[model samples]
Target: MNKGLTAKGRATRQRIVVATALLTREKGAAETTLDDVRAATATSKSQLFHYFPEGRSDILTAVAEYEAGQVLDVQQPFLGDLSTWESWQKWRQAVLDHYIELGQRCPLGSLTTELGKSSAEARAILTTLFTEWEEALFLGVRTLTSAEPEAARIRARSILAAIQGGVVMLQATGVTDYLTAALMTSTDPLRPTAEGTD
Candidate 1:
C-alpha cells in the first residue's frame, strides 16, 4: 500500500490505520463505519479517501494488517528469544494473558470474522499470521530440543494450534483455563528436562 509517499503522508496514513484498528477493536470490524473512523482519527472524508482509495474495504484491510502485526508484537521479548526454559514459560504466560484479558473481544477474532465474509484476502492474512507464528515457535523449539528438525517443526505447529484452539474456546466461554492448559501442556515438552538443553 505504501508504494510511494513522503514521511508525513505515511505518518498520516498510519495514524488513520491505528485509529481504525482501535475502533475495530471496540466495535467489531463489521460495525465500524468510515464516519466513526474519521471522527476518531479526526481525518476528513477526503483525507480518509486519500489514504484508502477503495473506501471502507481498503481501510478495513489496512486495519486487518495492523491487527495481524499486533498478534505477534504482543509476544515479543519472550517470543523473540525463547532460548531458555524461563523464556518459554514467559512466552506462554504472555499468550495466555493476552487472550484472557481480551476474552470475547479479541480484535483478531472479530476482524477475521468480518473480513471472512467478503474476501479471500482475509483468509490469506490469517494464514500469513499463523505461518509466521508457527515459524517463530519452531525456531524456539529447535533451540531447546535435540529432537529432529522435522519433529520440532511438528511440535511448533502443535503449539500454534493449541493457542488458536484455546483462543476460540476462551472467546466462546470467557475463560482462561483453556488457553492456560493448552499452552502449558503444549510447551511442557520443550522444558529442556525431557531431552536437550542449553
Candidate 2:
C-alpha cells in the first residue's frame, strides 16, 4: 500500500491509522466515524480520503491490521524467546497483564468482530494474525521440548486456543482465572520432570 510514497507521506498515513486505531479502541468501530478520525488526526477530509480512498471500511481495515500487530508487540522479549520454563512463565504473565490492562475492550477482537461479518479483508487480516501468533508459540514449544514436529504443532495450537478462550472468558466475566488456568495447564507438557526420571 505504501509502494510509492515519500517519507512524509508515509508518516502522515501512519499518523492517521494510529489515531483512528486509538479512536476505535475508545469509542468502538461502529461509533468511530470518518469525521472523528479526521478531527482526531488533524487531517483534512481530502487527505483522509487520499490515504484511504475507500473511506471508513479502508480505515477500519488499516486499524485492524494495526491492532493485530499490537497483539504480538506487547508480548515481546518473552514471546521472542520461550525456550525455558521461566521464559514461558514470563510470556504467560505478559499475556495476562495485557488483557487485564485492556479489560473488556479488546481493540483487535472488537474490530475483527465488527468488520469480519462484512469484509473478507478483515477476516484475512485476523487469520494472518492468528497464524503468526501460533507459529511463534510453536517455535517456543519446539525449543522447550523433545516432541516431534507434529506434536509440537498440536501443542502450540492448543496453547493458542487456550489463550484465546481465556481472553474471551476474561472479557465476558471480568475475571482472569480462566486465562491464568489456561496458561498454567497448557504448559504442562514442558514442565520439568523429577531427577533421573527420563
Candidate 3:
C-alpha cells in the first residue's frame, strides 16, 4: 500500500516535470508561468507548491534534466550500440533529422542559455549530458577500429564538438549544411584503411 502510494506520487511529480519541460520548450523559460504549468498539468496550485516549494527555479532545474535526457533520446539503440556501419549512419541521420526538424526553435538550448553558462549546476548538467553523448559516439568510432582506442575517443570528441557548434550555427542561419559538413569532417578521420577501402 505504501509502495503504491509512493509510485503514484512519483508519477504525479513526473507529470508536472514533463509538463513544465514541454511548456518551457515551446514558450521559453522566462515566459513560462506556474499557472501555465498548473493549467497544462491539470494540477492544483497547492499540488504544484507541494511538489516544488521553491517555485519556478526548482521546476526549471527539473525541466532542464528532462530536456537534457530528450536531447539525445531520439538516437536510441543506435546511439548506444554502433557496432556496424549501418548503425552509425542511422545515428547520424537521427541527429541531423532531429536538429533539422527543431530548426530555430530549440527548447533545450534556450533552457540552458536561460539557466546561464556560468551557473555551476547548469554547467555540470550540460557537461554530463555531453560526456554521456560522446561516449555513445566514441563506441561507434571504436567499432570501426581496434588499434586506436585513444585516437578514436579524441576523434569522437571532435565530432561531438562539431555537431554542437553546427547546431549553434543552425540556430542562427536556419541551415543544416554546417551540421552536415561537420559530421562529414569528423567521420573523415575514421575512413577505413587503404587496404580495406577497396
lDDT of each: 0.81, 0.81, 0.75
The alpha-carbon RMSD values of the candidates against the true structure, listed in the order shown, are 2.4, 2.6, 3.4
Residue range 73-164, candidate 2, lDDT tens digits: 99998999987778887888888888878876765456555645436787888889889988989999887875689998999999988888
Compose the digit string of candidate 3's lDDT tens values, residues 106-150.
654554565435245656777788889888888787776553889
Over the full model, what C-alpha lDDT does candidate 3 score relative to the true structure?
Answer: 0.75
Model 3 quality (TM-score):
0.80
- Candidate 1 lDDT score at position 100: 79
Candidate 2, number of clashes: 0
lDDT of 1 at 143: 76
Q: Which of candidates 1 and 3 reaches a greater TM-score? A: 1
Root mean square deviation (Cα) for candidate 1: 2.4
Backbone clashes, candidate 3: 0
**Residue-by-residue lDDT tens digits, candidate 1, 1-198:** 987978999999999998888777677777889899989988899998888999998888777788888888999988998777888888888887887788887765655566544356766787798788888888887877756899989999999888877877776678879888988899887765534443
